[model samples]
Target: MKILYWNCCGVGNPATVREFRQLLVANVPDIVFLCETKINSNRFQRIRSICRMEGCLAVDSVGKSGGFALLWRDGIDVSVQNYSNSHINSLVRLENEDVLRFTGFYGQTASRSRQQAWDILRRVHHKVNEGWIVGGDFNAILNLSEKEGGRSKPKVLMEEFCNILEELKLTDIKPCNGWFTWTNNREGDRLVKERLDRFVASDVILDKFPFLASYVVRQSRSDHEAILIDTKGSKPNRERMGHKAWFRYDTCWAGEQELKDLISCIWEKEESNMLAKMDMTRDKLGPWQFSRFRNLKYKIKGLEKEIIRLMDGRTDD
Candidate 1:
């Protein structure tokens, strides 16, 4: 099973909605948790249809700032336990009859009100004695190293965040892909990046699903990159023998002149057989598309390597 969490900033923009649809297509998560939707509960009906989810619980935004939505696919049994502006706590029963608690959390953005978020978490924890997994944009880093190009995070703040997790016996799951899940989108020295979004699971859940892992997905319109928690560390193979894979065109590529140029270049080649030409186009398009849109994967790999080197006390001069 897979659960995806994203702080979309807002879902009102058309571009954001398109990106959300694209994410839903690409990941096919069983459950989706969205933060900062910036829309009322009534507006989420369209989102539910887009997600193809049968279960939904939405928390309306205060004015234009904060909102939360927890959506689950058909056949999943999810019962809402408690909810507020900062979180949606649910008891989920898996197909195998195993029950677990899942919390979609949003930490207070303001430093002064941050304690309220912790207190809320504690209150929720007191009521549940089952396996638990909590995920979302905590708006706080575990340590100074989790941030870049920003004024140093306060030690007290980091300690407070850490103390809560320690008290709850929740362990942070390291993401296999991107290190930083958010960026200020500013240029040069003004830019800031941090690993604010994540998943923390109790030992009970970790022991139950030993292969569980988290991955940072590429971002499009939002500052926050989506985080996926996979109960199985690897994706299940769905390919069938003797079946040809279908290729679907993305609408987002329609406006790119480079795609037209690439097609023109392919068609201009000396192949006269129509079927062969189509096959050639498909083959060429795969690499071209990856290079165009999936370059972030390479960047993430490079960053991981650099981080490993730094942690090992080695650096290129």
Candidate 2:
């Protein structure tokens, strides 16, 4: 199953809605959690239908600043456990007969209100069994490296957030696709970037879905990038999802000067049209990328395995 979350920042905006719809169409997530919708309950009902989801529960905005929705597709059994302005807690029964507790959270912005947010989360967590997966904008960073281009956050604040997770027995699942989740959208030195949104789960759930991982997705607008939590795809599904058997530019290749020069030289050729140039570039990069660096990726994977073996002294999962 795939789960997606985004801090939309607005619900009434056409562009935002379009992006949201496009995401739903492309990825086909089983569950979706939206934050900062800035809409009321009645309006959210309409939005749910527009999203083409079967069931939903919403926390209406107080004025125009805060609102959220939890959505699930048909055939998934989801039960609400608890809810508040800062969160919507639920019990999810997956189709494969596994069960877990899910909480879609949006932390308060102010320091004082944020404490209340944490306190409530602690209280709710004690009521659930194992296999807990909580995710969203915590509005709190657990370390210094998670934020950039801004004044340093208070160290005590970071410690408090980390302490909460440690005590709750939750572990962070680092995202694989993007380094940051939000930006101030400001230019120059005024800009700020943060790893505010994430998914955390208890050890039992992580063990159950060993292939589960997250990818951070960015769109044209919004400071907060969306997160896609893929839990259904195992090793085979993953291979089928990727390795397209066709040529495409890997985003990671942009950082390599040799690859850049190769593309530039090919692109400068007397191309018939834009499509021809792109096809030629892809044809050239395919073999070159494989010959030089594809094996490097596998070597990195082997190194990762060695580290895991050193830590656990076992190759079996």
Candidate 3:
């Protein structure tokens, strides 16, 4: 399974929306966590539909800022445990029956709010009963090496970031791609870059899926680069390779009463009793998604390229 998480810096801009769609097509994540969407529910609903993800859960933007959203394709099973502006916590069941907690997280940008972020993470960590993976734009660095081309990052914040990870026993998954994951998109001395986007998970995750790896996908459309986690893929080489073999259910499905009833009904029909009710639910997920949502896996590609083609044609004309 492949998981991609990004803080697209809000998708309200027409250009940003197009770029976000492009990023989705390029990465094709089975599950996606997006931060700072800055779009209301009405608009975000349309965006998720265009992206063709059958499942979605969203935290509406507060005025013009602070929105969080999670989108996932068919075949993946996710159940949201809890959520806040800082993170959306969920349980994801892998094909191997290994269930892990995945927190699509966003740390505060302001130094004053750093303590609040840490408090939230600590609270979330207390509930971890399984392997955990927390990821997104952290907005802070562990050390100076993670930052470059910028003024010095305060040591106190770095120490705090490190301390929280240690307190939670979560370690950064090594990046096979280049180190930095965000840039100011500037030039000369004005430029700044930092490895602010990442996946840091409990060691149990590595113990369970030893081959699991995270990569820094190149950034073109946004100032922040995207992150991809391959659950059972090979090592990440300098080339940033990825392989997809299974699906993950988006936790948002658990929120809908209709889906809950449907899952309960499916759970009731099991006679073999070998597979857990959830396991049976996972079995039904694929066909359910396909039947409910058209197979738009490649639809975005065709539409995006055609739109670009027309734009180029207009430019030439």
lDDT of each: 0.85, 0.82, 0.79
Candidate 2 runs further than 4 Å off: 238-317
Model 2 worst lDDT window (10 residues):
308-317
Descending-TM-score candidate ranking: 1, 2, 3
TM-score of each: 0.76, 0.75, 0.72
Instruction: Show pairs that collide, candidate 2.
Output: 1-232
**lDDT score of model 3?**
0.79
Which candidate number would show the highest lDDT if scored against the true structure? Answer: 1
Q: In candidate 3, where is summed lDDT lowest over 10 consecutive residues?
A: 308-317
Q: Judged by TM-score, which candidate is best? A: 1
Report per-prediction Cα RMSD to one decimal.
7.0, 10.9, 14.1
Runs of candidate 1 with Cα error greater than 4 angstroms are: 235-317
How many residue pairs collide in each prediction?
Answer: 0, 1, 4
Q: Give the C-alpha miss distance for residue 250 in model 3, angstroms.
A: 32
Prediction 1 TM-score vs. true: 0.76
Clashes of 3: 4
TM-score of model 2 vs. true structure: 0.75
What is the per-residue lDDT of model 3 for residues 223-302, given as tens digits with 9 covering 90 to 100? 88788998766755554222111235667657667667878788777474746776667666655655544346468657
